[model samples]
Target: MTVSPLVWTLTVALILGMLVYDFVFHARKPHVPTMRESAIWSAAYVGIALVFGLVVLALWGGDFAGQYYAGYITEKALSVDNLFVFLIILATFRVPRQYQEEVLLFGIAFSLIARTGLIFVGAGLINQFAWVFYIFAVILLATAGSTLKEALKGDEEEEGDSRFIKLIRRIFHTSDEYDGNKLFTHLNGRRVMTPMLLVMIAIGGTDLLFALDSIPAIFGLTQEVYLVFTAVAFSLLGLKQLYFLIDGLLDRLIYLSYGLSAILGFIAVKLFLHALHENNLPFINGGEHVTVFEITTSLSLSVIIGILVVTVLASLYSPRGRAMSVVSATEMLSERYLQLPADATDSQRDAISRKLARQLQRMPRISDSLKDELISDRRHYMELLHEVHGEHLDYLSARQSSDDTSSAESAELERRKTAFSDIVNPAAESVGSAEESVGSTAPEGSSEGRPQHH
Candidate 1:
């Protein structure tokens, strides 16, 4: 008797137990999670999955363990690739950093249920008919086609309702605005579902579409339902953690599709082979098991690790092109901050942030004091720049002119003020980087760190 079912049940229980731990105790009493917190938690989540995989292998003999792990690795890699789109979705909504956690957690929760349903249906299909492999293979290839389009396609002229979303909206009335990550609520004294629910629904639905690729790909590796589900579940459980950790890094992995495409191509071939093995075709039916190159569980494990490492390194070390992508992203974020009008979503904002980050990066090289001064008064400097026109800045000296001030102390204060006159409007920068600020230089002026009143 195969122990697959029991093993998977226990594995699922363990997963839910951890998730419950996080929900009840761990994620509860937090001063908001910082980048540091994101990094730590992400590492912990991945580490748990890895260590857990080893335990699965140890307890269930080598074969089932391999099947489970191979499936898991494939799912995890696909999940990471899925995050690039999440980055876009979040940016589109302009989700706040603090509230982003709630968004992703909600998304992950709904996705787990949806994917579980998809997996069960898929397993049932495979059990019932041999021709289902062809259906599965076609869906996977189609998904790969769509994914390639998403990866390679440039900005669309506009966003539209997805077919599924449009259909849902057509059938039922839904509200447009978010209700603080609340899925459903009352509006205008009537019960209404929130866009937050729609967004989660969109995400969960898209993942189901993606499952068309992922489920079939893993099924190529294992016929065991328990192994299949265990791997898919484990992979998904880590997604919210990954989203928190890597939202900033998404743009860097610009070539993520190439990697994913290679993975898909690899799986597509595997599915074709598995189809060949089980088919009733005249020549191949009852034919001997044709061994392809030795692709073992250990190799798949190593391949997964290698792919993740290389993708990350390639992204970080690739050309510094992420600047505009991130800035473009910054512009898309309008839901939370109405800092910019719709038109301000241009390349200028991206350039400014990139320039500022680069300046901060180069601070040590120029002069530590200069660096500190630049950073410490960043907001103040932005403000001054905002107040003065280009011509006005041109008139000021390296220090505010002594004549420009009414008193000696005032002159000193004015100088300080000039140092920071460039600073203004932090809230405004949220929607998009204003072009006026990106390249605007401070006027040369004699200045003190204090502000001098005009």
Candidate 2:
């Protein structure tokens, strides 16, 4: 467990190199990775981790190597659990498949940094205080209970409305939609955060909760900070590829939560046993060393690996799992269809359309009749959009024409009234003048003229 400065430097460099390679090659271009691509990358990363374990075995003794393997297995299992939350976040945000890699990468980076700090603090506290193991055990036991409850209910979607997300919404001016992969975009003249940003924040917040269990669990396996850190780093590497490679498999792994609960429960008992063995508390066995059975690292590692295998096998063969597969596939496609943005580019739309069509064709329960009907509906939707667009244009044109006709008619009516007013006013003035002149001439001799006539 004695890690030299040289070893530390080399290890950090390797991890950084792997991250950079992932970024430059796999994540540089945004695309839905093909299954083959995901499989190859996932296998390669796992292979690298196995090789690293072998190197640790050669450098250190068998005990340290065993501890490393156990820690890695435990962390890897926990990482799978973390994936459930990741899927929820992605689906809740309706992240486009292409940008999902970016989101996961950001999440992984944030988790790594945050875990490193937690590891340091945890190591320091464990060195100073032996009771931390008891606390860790209690926490892991509680987490196991929580995990078991969630598994029984199958309620990963509850993470979609996490308080972290609500807090962010309250604090920031956020867009109701994504702006490609950008975390921030200009809406009008103000800056607004996108769903991408919100997802990353959610991932970070969840990772913090996960670390509360993971760090202590690893500490129980080995107090060597180097082993704990390396195990976590290796376990988390290439998780993005694993996410894609096993995307469909996740739903089928219905027993994973149960397996995880068992693992956590077992580890918690181990931690408590170790705490008893090294008891320093006044109330516990009169502060004396208790003769509790200590579980070896090899046993712990074997149990974890065995549980994971059994869980996977049981899930794949279970009737419920089989039923869920079809339902999950349908739900995934439905989400994709619903999430297609109205303002998405044509290429983006076509990509999603083709993806949905392929998924529909691959579904065994979906009859050919249904497939054809779904395809027909897709086409009909496009046709309806075009028809609606044309109708909207026609309606606008008719409205403009009616407005112009009304305006012209009003102008003609006003012009006719003006002409009539001009002619009538001139006649009225001349008649008034003629009446005034006749009255003026007759007024002087009106009585005398009238009498002679009589």
Best by lDDT: 2
* Candidate 1 residue-pair clash tally: 28
Candidate 1 to truth, TM:
0.69
User: Estimated TM-score per prediction?
Assistant: 0.69, 0.75
Model 2, 1-454: lDDT tens digits are 6899999999999998998888888677888898899999999989998888899999998899899889988999899888988998887787888999998988888888889999999999989999989999999999999999987875655565688789888988999888888989989889999988888888888888888889988888899999999999998898999999888778778899999999999999999999999889999889887998999988998998999999988888765565456445544544554454556564654454445444333344434443343333433322222222222233233434464557766565445334433432232222234343233221211222111110
Cα lDDT listed for each candidate: 0.58, 0.74
TM-score of 2: 0.75
What lDDT, from 0 to 1, does candidate 2 have?
Answer: 0.74
What CA RMSD would you report for each candidate? 9.7, 24.3
